[model samples]
Target: MAKNNEFLWRRLHSLLGIIPVGLFLTQHLIVNHFATKGVDAFNEAAHFMESLPFRYALEIFVIFLPLMFHAFYGIYIAFTAKNNTQRFSTFRNWMFVAQRITGIFLVIFIAWHVYETRWQVAIGADKADFNMMADILGNPWMFGFYVAGVLAATFHLANGIWSFLVSWGITQSAASQRVATYVTLGIFVALSVVGIRALLAFVV
Candidate 1:
């Protein structure tokens, strides 16, 4: 019974990471990518999202709750899960270790990000605009930190998609898994470019 419950929880965690969480991450990067266009472009995109109907309700139910569950459960898994890299160093094995590492890092990165941006906006301490981002990334250290954070986020999502496919039985054969690996790598590169470009836009 305990194993069964764990299996269910793991399944739900994988599903949530892909559905709303992955989708949201992609959308957020795209929105930020508008920064590359210009200040007004980014602000317009950001404001449009902020003005969505039932925004707060959607945020709490769709984004925050699922994210909290995934983040906390992922931390538990990260600390408890064993890796086979020591005995059998393989591509997937390394990826498994990397996934846990990135997951842990993301927890910290996301928390700081939300506090720096969302919490400030909520408390009227800052505006969620291009200017605000520009100021934050104005510091060289912060710029470097954000670059690392963006890379970590993209890698996590891309690799998570590969795992999601195999665990969900979407790609069971070795050949299919190989294909997924390439596809997910492409996703990582593409997202990293988008994210970093947005960050650079702020400092520029």
Candidate 2:
């Protein structure tokens, strides 16, 4: 029973970590979404986040802590998985591959995003300065990279949400499950378009 308890306990953490990350990503996207309205719009929102002391405290607890736990658990899962990719051949099986690919994308993109934005803020520069964003967007390479990141991150969030629900026993019926997965997929594509459109508005 102890082993069973441990399994359930770990699953609890995984569920909490998973859903929280998705919700937070939406919030993050909304903040970045302000970029669509131009730098001042993004700057106004970004300044509020960085300038406020209370918000910093919230970031430490809400963003950093959970992010650490979730990333670690994700790495653990990826490394310990005994199932080979070729072990299955269905569309469902392809999801595992897709998940890993996007997971890697998010990790890399988030690191670069922090280096560009948060790192500047750390050194007393306004990371959200509209001018900085404009400068970055002026680079075709950087712009392309961000476009890809936004797409991959959206897919990772939406698809992962459905997977989390199934793993947590939340969406149970086969018909309901199928519908939920489809809806999550649709949401992913919709968000990707929103994100790309936002980027284009900034660039053009």
Best by lDDT: 1
* lDDT for each residue of candidate 2 in 1-204, tens digit (9 for 90 to 100): 434575764685567555577677777777777888876788798778677778777777777777766666666666665656676777666777677677767777888888788887778775567677778888999999999899888887777877877887889998878998899999898788777876776677
Stretches > 4 Å off in candidate 2:
1-9, 82-87
Report how far residue 160 has shifted in candidate 1, in Å: 0.6
Clashing pairs in 2: none
| C-alpha RMSD of candidate 2 | 2.6
TM-scores, one per candidate: 0.96, 0.86
lDDT agreement of model 2 with the native: 0.76
lDDT digits (tens) for residues 1-204 of candidate 1: 434588889999999998889999999999999999999999999999999999999899888988999999999999998787999899888999999999999999899999999999999999999999999999999898889899998999999999999889999999999999999999999999999999999997
